[model samples]
Target: MKKLLIIAVMALSFGTYAQVDPTFEKEGDKVKATYFHANGEIAQQGYFLNEKLEGEWKMFNENGDKIAMGNYENGIKTGKWLFWEGDVQKEVNFDNNRIASVNNAKTKSPVVIN
Candidate 1:
């Protein structure tokens, strides 16, 4: 019975530590967002301007690996972005939220693998 009680307590503690829900905090007009993984790691974090995605945003996989990073303006994708898939890195350019160009580089750059 003592062993059972210890195990139950451990399980509950670990369970609470494993999963953390995402949180959004208001910062003036922008909303700061933070998303968490099942392992309680940060998955993505960024800010929303005027209720739209704005500024730089970073995305990570469940393993807490950065997979993609880019910027937004008024909820529209703009500028250059980088994405990672295994050993390859992809650079994408956006124009008015549309794909303007894409460049794939075979380099050993650590990136989030989604």
Candidate 2:
């Protein structure tokens, strides 16, 4: 599920590069990264540990609107992830790098899989 989701996102976002250079900073044992969009807006910001994504990460649109927010553990998706799609917000729960459940906030309906 995770792989499929990633591939779909990649396919959808064909222009996913920033013209400006990205910046990175060291925060104790972790490194903080801030990526920019082509128009210089912050695309995403997150922390990495030992070259792997760790802790909370946030994604934003070119106009500076936050589009998604989630957490990672040892580079793997974990816990609840929220994504904004048009007028709706989608919540996905992940366990062991796999989706456990998904809820559409606007519809108030949840889709769960064992």
Per-prediction tally of clashes: 2, 0
Candidate 1 lDDT trough over 10 residues, lowest sum: 105-114
TM-score on alpha carbons, each prediction: 0.73, 0.75
Residue 95's lDDT in candidate 2: 100
lDDT of 1 by residue, 1-114 (tens): 999999999999998777688899998889999999877778999999988998999999988788999999999999999998866899999999999999998889547877
Per-model lDDT: 0.91, 0.91
Candidate 1 shows a clash count of 2
> lDDT tens string, model 2, 1-114?
999999989876865642688999998999999999888989999999989999999999989988999999999999999999666899999997899999988843557867
For candidate 1, what is the TM-score?
A: 0.73
Per-residue lDDT of 104 in model 2: 83
